[model samples]
Target: MSNLIYNEMIKMIRKKRLLVITLILIVLIPIFTYAQYKMLQNTIKNVGSSNWRTILQQQIVDQQNRLASSRVPEEYKHLIKLNIQQRQYYLDHNINPNAPGAPTFVRGFVEQGISLFLPLLVIILAADIVSSEHSLGTIKLLLTRPVPRWKILLSKYIALLLNISFVMILTILLCYLISGIIFGYKGWTFPVISGFQSKGEELITDYVHVLPQWKYILMAYGLAWFICIVIGTLSFMVSVLMKNTASSMGVMLAALISGNLLEQVAHSWPALKYSAFTHLRLTDYLAGNTSLIPGMSLPFSLTVLSAWAIVSLVIAFATFTRQDVLT
Candidate 1:
């Protein structure tokens, strides 16, 4: 089993998916960092102060004004209200949510990317993990080996998990190294407020508490890792079911995109809460962000994602081990 996993890992390394993901991150992180820097500069210029309190107060006022306007949609009003509550919490605690640091950037990046961007990266890695073997006519060679079909599939799945972990860790390191040039590398120990809950328009502070920035990052990224694993597993299943790598990727991409669209209307459609895509943003729970769909909690999201992953794995294995390898 160990040899099989190692061989599979080597194959993945040879395929250059890791290197491709690295290149994508290398090209993108700096752009993100620069954009963040520009946004900070604009904030300072527009507010005419670097003081967080003043800037936050102005933001609160602006959001409140928007909330009062009829042009804002109902969903957006709820989101705006939640943002107001979170910002107010920061003000009351005298904490700077946008404290200049690489760690701060990482936290924000993970939160923003959890639902869509990070999952897309996972899809890139896992979408072709199985289908590519067929595309290259390697599946027959793989199955002819004395090893059991299930073991072969398991090895590939393990390799996929490792690659995803490596990519996620690389994302954090590269983001820190690149963004630190402008944001400074300090602030790991900065206090962060979390645990805000939403009950309709009202923000519940009863469960809120403070955490060190480092701790918050770990918790957030840990959830992100789980999310990536779930997404990768689903992609693996898709890769197993399809013979064409492109088709597998397209299917996962469409599903993810549709899931995002569903999130907008999830409130009206309660069944969406059970979807894996809706649960992909598990980091939001740690950040105390409210979902448009009510009744979502950390446990509920975890259960939904876990169920999807398990079901995907069962389908992938059952299909792969039984299906004839004509390629």
Candidate 2:
């Protein structure tokens, strides 16, 4: 199985998938850095005072005004309340509400970036894992070996997982390195407030815990990586069913982007709580905000994503073991 995984990795390398991922980072990391640069510049130029308490107080006022407006939706109010609570948490603890550095900026980016661009990279690697082999007749040659069909697919799955892990690690490293050049390398040791729980539209302030910033990043990235793996497996299942790369990628692409689309199209559907997409933004839970769909919790989202992943893997393996290669 290890050998099979190695061979699969070799194929991926030969296809220049690694290069593709690196090139994407080359573009994306700079964009993230630039965004942080602009944000810091604006904060410094506009805030008039450099004190954390004053800035946080200003933010509280802004949120209050929004809450006062009759136009704010209940769900958005919940998010605004979360933000206000977090800022207050910092102020009450005598901790500065603002910590702009490599770690903090990267954590902020990961929370938003995982839901958007990370899926595309995962899909590009996984969507072709099976179908491309079939299109090239390599799958037939592999199946002719004495090895079980399931083993071959399992090897591909492991290879895909390793690739996903690599992407996540590299993204964290690059985001920190590039941003550190401008934002300074401090704050990796800074304490952060996390472990927040929600009570309907309000954050349950007492239960939230404080951890080192590095630990929080690891926990946040771990959750995000689980979501990506779930997405990768689902795309792999689609790849197994489709014989062409285009069909496989198209199916996964639709699934990936539909996660965001679900917010607009399916938020009203109560049944959406069961959907994996509803849980994909588990970062919201960790970020001290309400789930994209109300009533969705982190544990619930994890279960939904795990169930979808298991069901997809079963379908893919079952279907592949019985599928005829001589079509």
Error of 2 at 63 (Å): 1.1
Error of model 1, residue 107, in angstroms:
0.6
| Clash count per candidate | 0, 0
Q: Which digits, one per residue and each the tens of the lDDT, describe model 1 over residues 1-327?
A: 999999999999999998999999989999999999999899999999999899999999999999999999899899999899899989988898888999999999999999999999999999999999999998888899999999999999999999999999999999899899999999899998888988888999998889999999989999999999999999999999999999999999999999988887888999988889888888888888777777888888889999999999999999999998764
> How much is 266 displaced in model 1, in angstroms?
1.2
TM-score of each: 0.97, 0.94
Report the Cα lDDT for candidate 2. 0.83
Q: What's the CA error at residue 22 for candidate 1, in Å?
A: 0.5
Model 1: which residue pairs collide? Answer: none
Displacement of the residue 3 alpha carbon in candidate 1, Å = 0.6
Question: Least accurate stretch of 10 residues (summed lDDT) in model 2?
Answer: 286-295
For candidate 1, the 10 contiguous residues with the lowest summed lDDT are: 288-297
**Pairs that clash in candidate 2:** none
